[model samples]
Target: MDIPFIDLDAQEKVIGKKLEGAVETVLQHKKFINGPEVSVFEESLAKFANVNNAITCGSGTDALLLPLMAIGVGEGDAVFVPSFTFVATAEVVSLLKATPFFVDVDMKTFNIDPEILRNAIIASKKMGLKPKVIIPVDLFGQPACYDQINEIAEEFSLNVISDAAQSFGAKQGGKPVGGLAHITSTSFFPSKPLGCYGDGGAILTDDKPLAENLMSLRAHGSGKNKYDNVRIGLNSRLDTIQAAILIEKINILKNEIEKRNLVAKKYSEEIDKKIQKPIINNGNYSAWAQYTIIYENRDQLSEYLKDKGIPTVIYYPKPLHLQSAYTVFPRYPKNLKVSEFLSSKVLSLPMHPYLSSAQQNFIISSINKYTKEK
Candidate 1:
């Protein structure tokens, strides 16, 4: 029995006919770029996220870029972000020639720590860099501690960008993750919880002016008309075909999220208590992007599971601040202990809505057997 890390084929089989129909509609219309389907999907996404506007773009990186460009995040601007997240969060800031200051995350939540964020802001100011933005990531699938993060942002007069690339279907305090920040960016990469067939992304915001700016930024800075280029921008429109497929996927996303949660719950219940499981805060819900756990000997455990034909992965083997490309950026001055520690111990097991009871039992028993033998 081969267990998949993420059973995308199982999900595709469930929605294959609807997906084919959507693609066929796009093929017949032939309005491939910026077609009617794009707007429809954007509207649907905005409604689902409970945001006033949603701007679709080419990829999650582009989703992060548009907002930075819209708000003038350029050279010398200090952009704060968690070191534990995917590089794209900091990559976008670096692309704009801005300085990315790394902040460590809370060990339990695997999200940015607000107290450290305040200290980072103060440190940035002391270094003569203008503090501008805070990009808090919803690492794995859970929403960050937004209540405290928002307060810190307000105190420092910093704009917040929620990196919802992995947490789109998650919620905190009964509100969707996308609506928790000034601007939220999400991916539609094939592996995301509410993914499309190919690369895609969207930006959600309540500010109309910013939404207009995002639309302009995603299309070579077009203004009023296509030929009228106003500002420097990238050609990053989310294609119509992907949008059409996303429509079908989004309709069933709620059920999929519930199923993923069920899978996560079972892992917590049955996996060895010595392995630190993902922690979700009260009134918060994760999309369960990856059911990650931390153990002392993560490499040995991963290899052991691999030998058993159970796939596993590490979210980030090294913190963003320690990466070679990011070595020049300013950090918290003190060591980011938690981020660095998590980098050494985190392991993501098989997690998806379609994972079976038998498959999960095998994975659980295999792990229990290994730990006991050790």
Candidate 2:
């Protein structure tokens, strides 16, 4: 039995008809750019996230970039983010000429550590840079320690941005992630929990002024109209076709999230003890994007799984500060022990809402065999 990772084909089969209808409607209308369907999709997204406003963009990177531009994040500004996440989280900071001060994440949750965040802010100030924004990543679909992060941000008078790129369908304290901070950004990449057929993303916020700014920034900084440009901005509009595709998927996202949670629970319960399973906090619900686990010999274990016709992946093999592009940036907690440690040990198993019981049992059995043999 060949096992695959992130079976997008399975999900496509479930939503294909609705997806086809949506795309056909867009094609018939001939309103490819900022079509009426785009607005409908944005409205549906905002309603689902329970936020007052949702602004769509070209991709997840643009979703992060638009917020920084709208908030005037520029040269010499310090943006604190986790080192353990995808480079895009900190890449945007550097793109704007702002400095990205990499902060370490908690070993258990794989999200930003609030205590280290406070220390990073102090360090940035000492280095003569203005601490502007705190971007906490929701790694592997688990929401970050937002309440604690928000409190620390407030005490320091820093703006908080929830990088819900992975945790779009997740919840913390019974509240959804999009409204967890001053601004929230999520990816609609084809592999994300709530993905479109192609590249897409959205920004969610309760602040009307900020939402309006984002709308302008998404275009060529259009003011009143595209002909009248107010500020320098990138061409970052979400394609109408992708918006149409996402509209159909969003309808059944809740059911998908529930199924993902069940899969994560089963993996945690049955995986070998030598493997450190994901630790989701009480009152926090994950979207279970990756179902990653930590093991001392991750590479060997991964090879063993591959030999059995089971595919696996590594979420990250290197921390941001250690990456070639970010080597010049500073990292907090000087040692950066947690982020570096996680990078070497973390390995993601095949995970998706459509993973069957038989496949899961096979995966668990293989891991048990490998551990016992060792």
Candidate 3:
């Protein structure tokens, strides 16, 4: 049997009843727009993340864009973000006509390097630009070093927008991931640990006024009415149907997270030393969004696994800097050696909460056989 990566069918089975009921409710109400389901999901998410407010949006990218608009991150401002992360993290900065100063990442956590960020800020100041915000991504279900990053932000008086797109249900020292930064953005990309049936995302913050601004921004900048257009904004509101689906999934989030961890632990323990395993921060608990590994000969391993009927995915075969769309920007470390290095070698295995033990064993055996070849 083919050992497919990320078994979504298993989860669908687990939450079938709740999901079915939610779909039925949406059908009955025919509230395809912002309805009661949206508000209910937002409330549950805010409480779960321990944030004062949560604003639902159409997608993860919009979730980032909405907060940037609310905080006035526009032209003449620079947002520091890791070059090793997804384009969305830096795309929001560019979308506002603001520049993004790409920083280096910590080797262990694959998050932004705090020291490098500090240096980048100083360098930007020397170049006569204002570093207004820091968009540290919680890459691959693990959070960036918010404690250190936040300290630097405080000293520099910059804002922190945690891109917890892959890390909504994660934790650090008993503190949840989303609340660690000033404002946080997360994705419900169907495959994410806490996902909706369709494209969905949310922005969380303790600042009430900012929340209000984002809510308005998501609805074409409407104030008290849909066509009001109080300010320039995008149509980024979450669908009531998707919100309803997410509400039911939220009920089993903790259980799903526990299972995800078990899968992660098993991968870490079972994989050979030749295949570099993922690292976890001592105070942090990853949602285990992707059980990625590194290898000297990625192509060979990929081919070997393909022959064994095991699938693999490259989380990022190329860093944002090397991508055609972002290659023009000036990146930190001048050359982005780590970012370039990781892109060619990092490979993600099947990662989800529901991978059965038998499937996992088959995957591990194939990987071990491939790596041990003479």
Candidate 4:
């Protein structure tokens, strides 16, 4: 049988019956937008995340943008984000007409390096740009250094918007990823830890006023009612069916996350240092969304894995500073040594909650054999 990087089918088989009935309920009601399922899902999500508010949106991108829009972060402002992250983290900042001050990341965790963040803020101030927001992505389901990041934000009086797109159900310092900072965003993109069958995401916060604004911002910036448009906003509401699927899946999300952790532990214990493994920091419990590794020769390692009937992926082969669209920005930093190094060496292996013991051994054995041959 062909191996899948993520075994969505294995999960479906376990929860198919429960999900079927939920889908049937939605069909029976014929409510596909802003329906009861959406409400229930939001309530459950807020509870799960330990947040007072949760606003569902169309996608992970919306999860980041809606909070910025609601918070009134706009032109003449700058948002601090790591260039090592997915484009969405910086893209939302740029979309609001706010300049993105690219920061470097910690090599092992692959999250924003707090020291680089402080330096970027100082540099931006020196250049006469006002830094207003900070967005840290929880890349690969491990929460960033939130304690230090939030402390730095407080000292600078900058708003923190955590990009938890890959980190739903994750924990850092005994608290859930959502509701840790001023605002947290997470995705339910079919491959995420707590994914729906389609695109979906949510913004979580304990701030009521912020929550109210997020609700308005989600529906074209309407006031009190859908017809009363008050501000310029994009259409980014979560569909009821997707919400329903999420609700059904939410029942098993915790179990799935636990299973993902076991898989990660196995790789960490068994995989030799020839394949530099990702680091799980102290007091942080990752959802293990993607077990990415940095090898000495990424391209050669990838080829070897493929020849052994094992697939591989590159989380990113290029840093944001190297991307064409972001090149036009003024005063771009020149020496992001860690980001450049990671871009060349990073590769992700086939990882999922349902990977069998035999398959795991096969992958490790294959790597050992290939490295010896080379």
- Tell me which residue pairs clash in candidate 4: none
Worst 10 residues of 3 by lDDT: 324-333
Whole-structure CA lDDT of model 1:
0.93
Error at 129, model 3, angstroms: 1.6
For each candidate in turn, the TM-score is 0.99, 0.99, 0.98, 0.97
| Cα lDDT of model 4 by residue, 93-153, tens digit | 8899988888888998999999888888888898888989999999999999989999999
lDDT of 1 at 183: 92
67-163: candidate 1 lDDT, tens digit per residue:
9998899888999999999999999999999999999899999999988999999999999999999999999889998889889989889999999
Q: Total clashes, candidate 3?
A: 0
**Alpha-carbon lDDT of model 2:** 0.92
Candidate 4 deviant stretches above 4 angstroms:
330-333
lDDT of 1 at 331: 87
Cα lDDT of model 3 by residue, 1-374, tens digit: 58768887888898888888998999999988988999999999998999899999999998898888988888778899898888899888998998888888877788899999999999888777888999999989998899999999999999999999999999988988778999999999898888887899999999998888898888888997986889888889889989988998888898889998999999899988888999998999998888889898988888888888888999888888787877776667798778788888888998888888999998998888877873
Q: What is the lDDT of residue 301 in candidate 3?
A: 87
Better of 1 and 3 by TM-score: 1
What residue runs in model 2 are displaced by over 4 Å at the alpha carbon?
none
